[model samples]
Every structure is written in C-alpha cells, then in structure tokens.
Target: MVTLEQSQPKAGERAYAQLLDEIQSGALPAGTVLAEMEQAARLHVSRTPLREALRRLVADGLVVQQSPRVTVVAPIDAHDIRALFEMRRALEESAARIAAERGDAARFAALADELTAARLDGETGRDAYYDLISRFDVELDRAVANDYIASALRTVRAHLVRVRRMARDRPERLTASVAEHLLIARALAARDGDLAAHATHVHLHNALASILANLENEGSA
Candidate 1:
C-alpha cells in the first residue's frame, strides 16, 4: 500500500519504491508491460526517472526487458519459489544461530511473548502480525551485525513480499508460521544456537511445502 507522492524528492527513488511495491503486491502482475510514457505519467515522474526506476527493477530481477522499448514484470513460478527458499534456508538458519549466540536475550523473550499473543483474525490483525515479524527481522539483523549477511537478506526479502502475498489467504499456514517463529524466538531467548537454527530449518521446510502445495492447487484450478 505504498502511496506515490508527486512531491517526493529523488524522483527516481520515489518512482522505484512505488513501482516495486505495486509489483510485489501483485497490483502490477506478471507480464504487465511498463510503457515508459504510460508509467511516467501514472507515477507523475518524467521519462528519465521512470527509466531509472525500471533499470533498478531489472537489476532486482522483478522486471525484465522484453525489448528495448518494453519492460514487463517478471513471472514467478514454483521453481523460482523453491530457489528463493533455498537461499532463505541457508541465510536465515545461519542468522538465527548467530542471533541466538550473540543477540539480546530479553528482546527475543519479549518478541516470543508478542508472538504468543498475536491475533490474525482479520486484515488489520494480519497487518499487525506481519509488522511484528518485520520488527523481529530487524532485531535479528541487528544481532547478527554482519553487513554482508544483512545485505543479502535485504535482496531475498524484496522478492519474498510477493511470495508472502501468495499465501495471504491461507489462515492455517499463517497461524503455523507464527508458532514456528515463536519457537525460534524462544530458542534465541534461551541462547540456544543449535535449537534456533533447527527451528529455522523446520520453519522454512514447512513454508516451502505449503507454498508449493498452494501453487500446484492453483495450477490445477
């Protein structure tokens, strides 16, 4: 739900952010052509800033240049989802282990309590829950204190927004994810690196399975 503000400074950045949000949210779905003039007008930016934004999206693998004049949103499929999860499993498991060993225990403890009490009944509740998860990710990144890992994670997370949206309708999976995250948080609070890593592994495993299943169901339908 990122709004495009015409008055924002750094017009390229503003255009990029708005376009990225639209692509990730499926507002601009796969194969949607991004005509320079059309997008420039819609986003209230000039051609130069629009091109800059498109170039950035291309670099992020969220858009593809169909031709010199045509850029379209990239298609995501089951194989792509699996590849994304492979990277997530590696980076997140390592991050959880490192965070458990060196992160602030009280902070994770508080996060675990919040996860325990999280409500996911409605859209607002789900938004709040996701916001809490974002907080947890921030804390985990801070605890690891590794610029390289954090940078890699930032890239992985950009694509993950679309993956998460795909599963938004699955309340069961969402509920399970909260429990899985709670386990990892508690392990971190206890300073149990091995347990935290194992929990992360399990969580990723379950998530990949659920997402693949949903994808298959969609294809059949």
Candidate 2:
C-alpha cells in the first residue's frame, strides 16, 4: 500500500486521506476502535480537524460513531460484499452499455492494448496494472458523460478499494483479473454495447467470487 502524506494546510483532508488509506490497506482493520484523543495525537492534528475527518469517514460508511467519543471502522463480511457487488453490477453494466455507445473508441482500444501488454510479474507491474484500471474507470466516466452515474461510481469505488486489498495477495486472482479486464476493454473498444456489458458482468462475477473465497480463507486461517 502507498504511504499517505500529510498536508499541513488542509489538516482535515490529510487526516481523512491518511485514515482512509490505513483502513483500505488493513492497517486499521474492520472494527478497530478510533478514539478521538488518541487518533488526533496519532495523526498529528488538532482534535477539531480530526473530528472533521472522522465525520467525513462516517459519512463515507468507512467509520461509525457508536457514541459521542467512540468510533470504529465498519465491518466487512459476506453481506456487505454481496450488497456492494449487486449495486456495482447494476451501475457498471449500465455504464458499459452507455460507454460503448458514446465512448472514445481509440481511448478504450489504447487501454485494451495497455492491458494486453501489462506484465504483473512484480510489485511495480501490479501497481501499474491497478493504475491502468484507474485510467479505464476515468475513461468510462468521461464516455458516459453523466454526473449522477459518475458520483455513484465514486461511492462504489470507495468501498471496492478496501475489498480489493483483500484479494491482492492472491497471484492467481490477479492474473485472471487482468485477463478479464482485457476482454472488457476489448469489448468496449469494439463499441459493442451488449458485449461490453456482458463482459463487465462476467468480470464482476469472477471478481466477487475471488474476493469472497479470499475472505473465507482468511477467516478460516
């Protein structure tokens, strides 16, 4: 996981980013208690800004305030994963259809080429692969040209970042995911709306299965 840097001018945003990074990276795992005084000191910010940061995280569903002073990271389980994917499937499938119809073919084709060339043989490659996916997401949102869908996708991506970390240790899943994304990228490049949507559906299905299996394995271990 990338280290989050502190921003002196915007303490609240910096705290929020740092905490969010820690939460997503499992450095601050689910159900970990976040005390105001402790976290404020730990994050090296004032209580007021730390409180603001915690409130933002609360709104993001990454943290929950149990009382005036007690806050904890939200739990991640089968139910949460399932619900998240259900919405992801709906939103992404629709986005794929619209993007295929209106998106930049050359851009998606370039992305497909990038995926095809991605090695994923080492940490640097893996980081590059994830960055490629981020670029693809940006292109999709741009192609769809819908503010509402983009906003909703941002929300889903936030949760997905945490879930994705759970499966990152699996090399097999990582390879398969790259292949799956290549297919979706190709379908989008071809401007085949149905094919693009179907490819996205399949990718999400495989992704969810991999994530759940990883979670179960960790639980058993």
Candidate 3:
C-alpha cells in the first residue's frame, strides 16, 4: 500500500514497512527467500537500502539470516503464538487496570459505543474494526501515561499482525471479540480497575484459544 514516491526521503524505512506488511499479510509466507538483488529491483530501491531494510526485519524477528547471503521470513506456529500471548496478557492486563484508574470515562464510554456498533461483514468492515481498536489503544496508552509500557506495546503489536492474520476468519470469533472489547471499554468507563483488568485477561484468554484452535484445524486440513 506504500508508494515509492512517498518513500523517497527514507527509502530504507519505506522498504522495511512495505516488506513487513507483505510478510504479515502472508503475501511472503514463512521461509520465503528475500534475495537482496531481486527484492531491490522489485521494490525499485538500491542494494544498500534493501540491505538496511532486511537488517531491520531481522531485528524485528520477522526475518532471519540463514547465511551471509540468504534471508528468509521467519516461521510462525503454536509455540510462538503462546509465547506472544503470555507477554500480551501481562502487558494488556496491567494497561487495562491503569487505564481504568486514570483514563477519562467519557472517552472510553465513546469507544464502547463504537464497538457496540462495529460491523465485520467484509474486508472494509474488518479494516474499520481494526481502526477502532487502534484508536482504543491510543486512548489506553494516553490514559496509562507510561512511556515504557507504550514502547513495549508497540513491539508486541508489530508481531501480532501475523498472529492475528493466522487466526483466520471466523464470524463467531469476530463477534465475540467485539463484545469482549465492549466489556473492557465499559469497565474502563466505570473506573473499575479490577473489572477492566479481568475483562482484558478473559479477552486475551479467549483469543489465544481461538487462534490455537484455528492453527490446529489448518494443520489437520
């Protein structure tokens, strides 16, 4: 979705973003070789910028260097997903508690209303729901007012893209997720720290189970 012209000033950063998006979207699936020269030509960037981008992806754990000359997209599976959820549960539970204590009730109430009305019929609806989630994250971060927590969340979120995509398209799960989010938002609006934290924990627990089940189903298929 990124344009080359918009990436003129910082081509390396642009390349990183574009490549990361592709990997997360499963366009470049696990173990896809990222030949430097080939990618550079394809992305219309020079070798140096492409290498810089690869290095960033490596640091992000989205790509790995098999050798000096070979790079490939990293694999995703059950163990990795569980590890991610462990950390996500810790951070999100703590964040929800803090946000409940300090966040503006009106803001979270508004977000709850938005979630209540969210539609997940198709790609556009799904994208809109994600945007709403992003807005909720921004508000939660703002409410928490912790630089370190926010930084850690940004890192966790980057990897979550692939995990979420792998979670597959289940209408029931999508509907349940919106309901879970609504409960968390309403708890925050009520300034109920314990309820907010509990709601967040429950939501993450359900999400992890759903993703694991989906992965198992895929493997069986």
Candidate 4:
C-alpha cells in the first residue's frame, strides 16, 4: 500500500479528499484505472496511505477494487441513475426537514449565496456550477445536523455526480436547476420544515424525471 509523509493533512483524509475531488470532477472518469503506484508517486505519498484513501472511496461508492488492479471508479448505467435519484429524493427530503427544524439561518444563507454565485457563473457559460452544487450539498447537510443522514446523502451524491452532470450540464437545464435550488434554500431560510421538505422532494423528482428522459433519449438514438 502507498503511504504519504505529508504532515499538513490527515493521511487518509487528505488522500480521500484529493481522490474524491478528482472523481467528482470527472478527472478520473468511471472505469479509469487508478494505479496505486502511479497515484502514490503522483501524489507524493506512500502506497500505504494511498490504499487507505482508496478504501475510503470504496466506502463512499466512488471506486471498486478488483484483484490484479488497484481500483477504478465503478461504471454506472441507466438503472444506477434512477436508483441514485430515488435515494436522493428520500434522503434530501429528510435532510431538508431536519435542517428546517435544527439548522440556523446563517447556514441556509450561505447555501443560497453559493447557488446564486453558481447561477451567475453558469449563465455566463462558466463551469463553476458543479463546484457550487457541491458547496450547496455540504451546507444543506450541515443544516441537517445529523451525521448519519449527512453520510447517507453524501454517499448517494457521490455516485450521482456524473449522472447529475449528464442532466445538469446543459445550458438551459443548468440555469433552471440553480433556480430550483434557490427555492429550497429560501424555504429552509424561513425555517419551514414542511415547506423545505416538500420543495426539496418536488425538485428532486423533477430532476430525476429530466435525467430519465435524457438517458432514454440517449439510449434510443
């Protein structure tokens, strides 16, 4: 196993974030091999630490390890997309409810700010939308104030990043998606648990519908 001597980060945590960032950005697209030795050298860490990082990603549903190869991001199909969004609908609805009840205005405000910034960037043909969505997810989870719920949603989000990109990458859809996010943020800001949960569920259902339509169109064409 590769290991790193870097003191600035918790070995496993640092490796996890770095690798996960690459995965979410599609830098390491699904089905790409992650050579432990290569990553260890590239990341300037030890094999021991790098292996630990891979394990963390495995737990997060970001990668799959098969013998004879270190690990690779798992390939997802159409079914995976539907299942992922279904999971998202359930977990996000619950998170939105908890956030409205337990989370503070400041956190909700920050989420709104992130969405606003991303919307502006996306309008101008910039690609900061993904980053902003990530920030929103984090803030929303923090608002929930429950680690278990946060972890579950985080795992689901990890798997959906690429598929969501498939749905959110279009210029028109990207803008509309951000608008939808703002609606949820507003509801949470007002501390309306019922409103927040309902908005979130409805939004996810719509997004899921879009994804399914897009994928079906792709398959048939």
State every prediction's TM-score relative to the real structure.
Answer: 0.95, 0.93, 0.93, 0.80
Q: Model 4 residue 151 lDDT?
A: 78
For each candidate, the alpha-carbon lDDT, in order, equals: 0.94, 0.91, 0.92, 0.78
Put down candidate 3 lDDT per residue, 121-183, tens digits, no spaces: 898998899889989999999999999999889888888989888654888898899999999
List the candidates ranked by lDDT, beginning with the highest. Answer: 1, 3, 2, 4
Candidate No. with top TM-score: 1
User: Candidate 1, which segments miss by more than 4 Å at Cα?
Assistant: 1-9
Off by over 4 Å in 2: 1-9
Q: Provide the global lDDT of candidate 2 against the true structure.
A: 0.91
Clashes of each: 0, 0, 0, 11
Better of 1 and 4 by TM-score: 1
Q: How many backbone clashes does candidate 4 have?
A: 11
Query: Clash pairs of candidate 2?
Result: none
Model 3 spans with C-alpha error above 4 angstroms:
1-9
Q: List the residue pairs that clash in candidate 1.
A: none
